[model samples]
Target: MREFDYERAADAAHAVATVHADPDAVFLGAGTNLVDHLKLGITAPGRLVDVSRLPFDEVTERPDGTVRVGAAVRNADLAAHPLIRARYPMLSAALLAGASPQLRNLATTGGNLLQRTRCVYFQDPTVPCNKREPGSGCSAIGGFDREHAVLGASPECIATHPSDMAVAMAALGATVRVLGADGEREIPVVDLHRLPGTAPERDTVLHHGDLITAVDLPALGWATRSTYRKVRDRASYAFALVSVAAALDLDDGVVRDARIAFGGVAHKPWRAFAAEDALRGAAATEENFGAAADAELAAARPQRQNAFKIPLARAVLVATLRDLAGQEAR
Candidate 1:
């Protein structure tokens, strides 16, 4: 690991200003992801502004039925929170579905959203990775890309974002509260992450000084019927090959409303807008669910080894929707 100076932040304003003033400074939460990058020589920041102990660690509920999760809240705590487990079960399920118990205990909400890709090329500094160093070239483009992206990829990079929590948040239409150098702003979770276009180095839309303070989940009464399903090589402690976060609202035998997002298929959480569009006002059936998946995945561009992801993603989406709709029918 590289030598660096560390300072515990006094407050949110101080943390934002400190990191914003220095281009080489970065905020430290629980050091779950950042510390790994530091040891791997992927990132070597001159200063670390410790924000783990800051006041941004509470999970507050508003009268408007919105739940705000602090950035510093541990993943385990967030997942186990009574309100979260009760109201936003999909979010809780997604959180528990990620990483190991030890990691979940130490990982923070902000750190999870800011996590880099798990692609081997991006982690190994010895090889070429456009995400690690722009203009270098993407090693995963033609290399072993079994776990690469099938949607929202560019010639420069095909790496997918690895955040199960973000996928659920996208389906829930959560908003991220950020404190930046300019001021404060709220960005929708779906909009926070962008496609890996020419600039594969940029994972999120957040500016250099922007600090995520909390994530707000708006009240969607039907969210209680939501669920998250993930498929990987193994059962646990594995990144998803294909995953779905879905919430369905059924009116009699027809779909009244729906929210769907896919993971492990795109640069960011793949929001299934087309699928949702196809489901609304349509019959809640397996055939319709398959058609909805087909509508959304029609634009999928799969690579050689990972062409299977397209069908896998389709199956996962259909199954997830069927399961949610079945629950609603009951």
Candidate 2:
């Protein structure tokens, strides 16, 4: 561990100002992911501003039915929240499918969203990874890439975003409230993460000192019938080889609306916009589901070791949609 200054912030304003003033300062929330990077020598901040005890820990349902989850809310608490489990079950399931119970107990909603790729190359300081050090060639490009990206991958990096919660939030169309030097603003969850373009080092659009206050999930009645399905090599504590977060709205066997997002396959959460467009107003059948999956995966550019992810993703999306549609019918 390296020597660093530490301060427990009194409030949000103080936290934001302290971090924004120092270029080498970072906000510490739960320190679940940040600490790991610190130990691995991936990041070294001169100062750590503790924001875990801030007032952003509540989970409230607004009058308009939007569920606002404070950034500091623990993943376990959010997963077990009555409102979350009853309404947005997909989000709850996604949270549960992530890290083990011990880690989830300390992981915060904002910290979970800020988690970087779990690519082996990105974690090892000795390896050449663009995400770890910009301009260094990506080792995963020609090396072990079973867990790498298949969609929206640039030559600079083929790493995938490793957050199951963000995938569910993307499908749910959640909004992230941020506080920065310029004051507060709202960013859609889908727009929060960036594709691995020329700037693979930047995982998200968040600039330095931008603090996530809360995530607002819009009231989508259809999401009540949604679910998150993750397929991994192991049964527990394993990241997804392919995952699907899907919601369906059916009326008399016809799909009225749908929302879909795929995980473990892209630089960010792969929002199935093409699939949603294909399923809208169409019959909610297995055949239609296949068509929708195909529409979205048509743009996939799988790498050598991860070509199987394309078919695996297609199967998971179709099966998840089918299950949701069936549940709605019952």
TM-score of 2: 0.98
Candidate 1's C-alpha lDDT?
0.92
What lDDT tens digits, residue by residue, belong to model 2 across residues 155-175?
999999889999999999999
Off by over 4 Å in 2: 327-330
Q: Clash pairs of candidate 2?
A: none
Clashes of each: 0, 0
Worst 10 residues of 2 by lDDT: 321-330
- What's the CA error at residue 239 for candidate 2, in Å? 0.9
Query: Residue 66, candidate 2: how far off, in angstroms?
Result: 0.6
TM-scores, each model vs. reference: 0.98, 0.98
Candidate 1 TM-score over all chains jointly: 0.98
lDDT of 1 at 212: 98
lDDT for 211 (candidate 2):
98
Candidate 1 deviant stretches above 4 angstroms: 327-330
